[model samples]
Target: MDRFEVLSVFFGHKTAASVVAAHSHPYWQLEIVTHGGLRCAFAGDGFALEAGDMLLVPPECEHGFVYDKPGVSWITIRFERAEDGESRWGGVIRGRPFTDRLVSSFKIAIPGSADKPYEKAFVGGFLDALLHYIRSDEFRQPADSPGALLGQITDMVLARGGRAVTVSELAEELSYTRSHLSKKFRAIAGESLKAYIDRLRVQKAEELLKYREDSISEIAADLGFGDLFSFSRFVKKHTGASPRELKGK
Candidate 1:
């Protein structure tokens, strides 16, 4: 499997007026705005982004940035092109909750760890997933709509990094009725709120399970299941696959 072979990651915030001289390199660059805004010109096209916005710069595509606004924060991830990864992703890339959370996960990808290989694969997988979503209009739900609201819920779930969050808690946090959330979620996402979460849970569960570093019980707890039995049943019901099976065991 191709790994990201991450080169460097920089987390910085700036308020002073600054200009990043236009330049290009032989590797790839992924830049995300976590707060404030940035203006950049990429390949003759100018773009500006605020929090949750991002862009991927391909190898040797000249680009530069100007930070004029205060409280501008960003995460810059630069990596070598994988030996067996997608072609490339360039220009201004829109952001999503899941994407934001995954990018945030990079904060935990410490160097010289036993799980370095897994981390590389995780980074590569994130890029692949992002590329897939960015290519499709289907993933672009209407802004400030029900789909957008669901995005907030997704942000909460992923940010917890696998902790179980009850639907009731989500409803209360978002201050929406369960019926309304379910109704709107289904209308925009074409799936019930319960189903959407189940699917997301399964996807997260599988990712962790594949690593085999955490015990099934631990994984279950992270996914918010009370017990291994419940987690197994849910997995089987939704995917017709046991946790062990999904774990590639």
Candidate 2:
């Protein structure tokens, strides 16, 4: 079957810390925060990133985090290809995944709610501006080369399904030391790589149980689990349900 993708960008704020379980994107996730902090778990590791930060997470990269304090606002842009060649995280683009690079913040300050007409218009314009900003080289230097590198990495991760990928391996592929890449990845993507991947696996397992014809054991193996017991345990831990029970309902 062909993968699906979506593209979107929006800003959000929070008042307290919230923990999100590991899960994958149906599309790509790019987030830039203007206020507050975020503590995220990706690919089995956790990181804390604050304002003046962004994150680039490919599809199916397990990740989750807590929104620290309140008055936290951020903008996220998701992109994906329309056809079979591109796959994405839901409401985010993951197709043609890329490495994280510093990009200038495109802040569109608008005051209103999503229900307000002016707010809608402002958001629309904001998105348009954001797309243009990324397309421009204000964020990436050396022309398009660096920017292209970011995109290439994302695309590769999404294309391969981003499962069981290690930090060392990712660093090696990008010709960076693990720590260097980790720092850069967090700066651009808004979360650690490991956290994202872990979220991906759990999220995929949920979908498989909910919507697919595959059995629990089958789903487990497909997700690279060593055994059904482990997969079952994971499912129970996350959703408070056994695979069979989730499907049975």
Candidate 3:
């Protein structure tokens, strides 16, 4: 019943402002732009990633981005070492040769590779390899049991994005106290549970704004916002773009 691994695939359009803004994450991120272009800054060094290009950014690297078009889609995998293990990664651990190999081997394009059935199936293979590698003693030491809690909590969030989520609710589901989950969620996700929830809600809302024809008010209500004004404020705070502007782009 313990979920300690993370494997995910995201395929859809995205905006420039959605990708930009310097931020650091606590887990590894591997991404490939299928059709559009993306510019990312990793640890002060920047590179423009385009169609067919692959990127492997280690954890804790300060990165920001700008996308060329609205049809930006990619896959990302986030994972961590076992608890009490020394394989703790932060602020950009140098990627291993195996990491580079896995990145190069993954195909994230939609209508995927012509030969692949789905982008998920293609990129999912690399994620599978990464998990196997991370579990190996040569790649990372065994971590303690307490550390696995964060991965479990994050898995829940990703599986059910902002769906009736709350600290207390998570605690009850995971059989942990609220305070413990809060602290570990922050430590592992690089943000508080509430913060991650807000980010997830906003990100989901952004996707809807880009792809759906819903009006601002409708979008707001659909995303569980109290009202248009509140949703507008939330979108502005995170992405620095109004709903209209985001939709238009």
Candidate 4:
């Protein structure tokens, strides 16, 4: 089975003076606070997370924060969902309640120096183990729960292969009114449906640019962009790179 792909990982420290403005990313983020505390604002809500607290911020959520105390330290892993929709983390993590055990498990899995020869494999295994613990009986939910619905919607968006999808279309297929679906989605997923779709499309474009020999124009058309210029703007907005630059990377 495919698993979540770790795009980057690092340990960071912040002083009381540190501040980050509202920003969003196109990859899932797992952050574990190991020292001091942080004040985070997301989805119009605020949270004070301290030592042993773990926060999972889904893609496209507008979040910002500041250190609440001196010497705030944390471990962050940015990851992308598997193209095959088989990532264990994706299904287990959406709207799931955090637990002390889960926090401890993540702390234990923290990676060593990035310079280590086995760093990548070690971090990947660590994430797999952490997800394993989270998927245990204590954290698992019924198939009909809100978390499951969120997971289902995520899978559908990913499976579209960058095809444009609207909230109304998804709601109609799910037998829900658009307004109700939008509210519930934001409440559970921590981001708007449109933002999620945009990020997913850019992610798909990145994959195609890296792995396929198709011309940029072909990719733009395939992703439903009106023209190359439109696709260029969309990619730059989300990824901060043009098609040529991304392909070079």
Candidate 5:
């Protein structure tokens, strides 16, 4: 079955300063800071995560944190992808629907919530609810900070599948001028607007090549490339590998 299965769940309490070295895993993980604070680094970018904040780390992404604040408590849910929903993005999650879900999940977990061994099914249910929420337009919670804006941008790209979009289009969709939008994106993400989109495209293309049974040309067109050559060039330029090589065929 292509559904997410909980591998392990734990509620953590830290009383002293600690550092978790960067590491990667083949499965997905969710971390919610229920109390105190933590500085988490994903892909070398540091996000000061506090209470009422959450993080969903995707497969194979290197992440770690410095828990310097005593009395910090968190819930870590490690799960594997038996389900095929790649529409989700990883990063700092805060405010609105996401936070609301975090609180509820913990509330249930604390009092025999599914984050435990005997009640792992509860975690799966929570994940299903989350996936459903993410697939809906209602998931576009208001962004009160740059971090929220970054999540919005990531969601926008994932929502696009493999298609291409311009900065002006993104700005227009977000109701901001091209320059202003790009500046904020760069400041928060530490990457140029175009680079981020292109990188996202490359990631999508790589995923399709590896998993989906789409032909090279078809994948190229799906990503909005004018031709197979252009798509091949893009994949090569960014990843130093051709689609065939990536596909291992």
Candidate 6:
């Protein structure tokens, strides 16, 4: 049977100048902007998404965002294919409007966490409805070749786990010049390669700190920091908090 499993849902808010550098997930992502505006770039093309704009990204498609206004808020739902290995939907759908009634229904019906069977069923039904609406229209956007390559690069970086990866190394592995890869990545991701890596490392460190009981020193080493001081400095630079402060939270 063709079915979808809801993996996670997150409500996100970002202030002005915030950036989510290019990355892809193994599951499909549906992002709806509820407030303010942002630019979403994928497959080498950019879409200016404003309030109420919805973006449906296929699995493993490289995408990122840059907030264009203050207090940008969005709802993201991640789901994966189940049972039948084929996806029920194809291509990307952008800027579609959900009915006011549907939006209100979502607010009232959605569970805070999908721990119960009913909650899971409700979310799955919502996704089915949303996907049906998206597919009713014949809008299909083709993928950009360069954007696909950038996605591969992103995947490589994520595969490195706690190890550090340099642009030079990625370029060599991909058989492209460092300058070329850097330029293409910046154009699509709206951030430099180094900044993207630093942001990713900080994000990983935050996850480990929150979920895992690893010591700060151990976490630092896992993230490829030379020492505790360096790791603390990096965290402070990116998050404005020390590792101890974050871990305590």
The candidate that wins on TM-score is 1
Best by lDDT: 5
Worst 10 residues of 3 by lDDT: 88-97
Expressed as tens digits, the lDDT of each residue in 14-71 for candidate 6 is 8657788999888888887778888988766888887766778887888998886888
**lDDT tens digits, residue span 1-249, model 3:** 112334454444575546568887876666655567777777778777766555666568777777766777755455443354345332222244345445546542433232234544445455557546555553443223444555455556655543437889889997879998788777766788888777777788789889988798887887677878888898999899998889998
List, residue by residue over 1-249, the lDDT tens digit for candidate 4: 336667777788876567788788988777777788888777667788877666667688777887858899988878775555444233213232234444455456554433444665556666666666565653475657887687667667876789889999889988899999999989988899889889888999999988889999999999988999999999999999999899888
lDDT of each: 0.76, 0.60, 0.62, 0.74, 0.80, 0.75
Per-residue accuracy of model 5 over 190-230 as CA lDDT, tens digit each: 89999999899899999999998878888888888899888
RMSD of 6: 18.5
In model 3, which residue pairs have backbone atoms overlapping below 3 Å? 82-143, 83-143, 83-144, 84-144
What TM-score does candidate 5 reach?
0.52
Q: Model 1, 174-211: lDDT tens per residue? A: 88887776677778778777776777777888889988
Best of the two (4, 6) by lDDT = 6
Query: What TM-score would every model get versus the actual structure?
Result: 0.59, 0.38, 0.41, 0.45, 0.52, 0.49
* TM-score of model number 2: 0.38
Q: Which segments of model 4 are wrong by more than 4 Å?
A: 1-139
lDDT, candidate 4, at 123: 62
